[model samples]
Target: MIVLLNLGFTITSTSQAADKIAIVDISSIFQQLPQRETVAKKLEDEFKKRATELQSMERDLKIKMQQLQLNGSNMEPDARISLEKSLIAQRDNLSTKAHAFEQDNRRRQTEERDKILNCIQEAVRIVATKKNYDIVINANAIAYANNAKDITNDVLKQVK
Candidate 1:
């Protein structure tokens, strides 16, 4: 019985050892990727001019509001009313432009993120297949894993 038990335990341990598992820190991989920075720069360059224009428009609106507050009481009623209407129109236009800018920025960010994620996924697949990893899991989803099982650096090298 003792011999049988030892044989059984040995087989179980050997089988478990053969069931390979790998862990990867995908967020870290994304951050470490050179493509991430290149994408960020591209997005920034695409939107910088519009962002600057929006800021200038915001500043101009604030100044107009301040001017109206200071001089409304001294101005003729018709002029005050016209100036108020102008400010309202300017504010509305600025609001619309700002909202559009935010939406566009979000869309661009999503696009860049998707592109990076696709690259990471491809890298993971290549490494997993090449290394014969039975399973590869995101490090964030796992409670604990041995460093020996980590393939993040391998994936990062592929990404770079």
Candidate 2:
């Protein structure tokens, strides 16, 4: 009984030293969350749709170029000039469209990243409050941590 009492005291002292400051892996939970997967799928579909549209435009441009090549020898000079002008315009339009898509995709990706980060931050705050932790550190900021000190699962559950 005396040994058991002493052991309990030692355990309490060790645990007290760990109090009020916790470490959480926000990236791990963000990667594992179902909402993140949903957001990723939506982004992926948007990217794919843009890629498909660009491919169709490219195919059309190639076809038009081939047609121009096959018929160029017999065409009047005005017709040839007009065709070349139109092809140049088409190429420029395609380039502009591609640039716009890239910019929009990047913007959307940034917004999504911010959204996930905000959610993680909110969860960390709530978990820290509920668990009586004075400060919650992000795992990325720490070099090494005890697994026993990981509060990621609790934060994940609270966030979800």
Candidate closest to the true structure, highest lDDT: 1
| Clashes by residue pair, model 1 | none
The global C-alpha lDDT for each of the candidates, from Candidate 1 onward, is 0.91, 0.88
Over 1-160, each residue of candidate 2 has an lDDT whose tens digit, in order, gives 9999999999998778677678988889988888888888999997998889999999999999999999999999999999999999999999999999999999998899899889888988888888888767888898886743678998888778
Q: Which 10 consecutive positions of candidate 1 have the poorest summed lDDT? A: 13-22
Clash count list over all predictions: 0, 0
Considering every candidate listed, which one attains the maximal TM-score? Answer: 1
What are the runs in model 2 whose C-alpha is more than 4 Å off?
Answer: 1-18, 44-52, 69-77, 146-148
Clashes of 2: 0
List residue ranges in candidate 1 displaced over 4 A: 1-18, 146-148
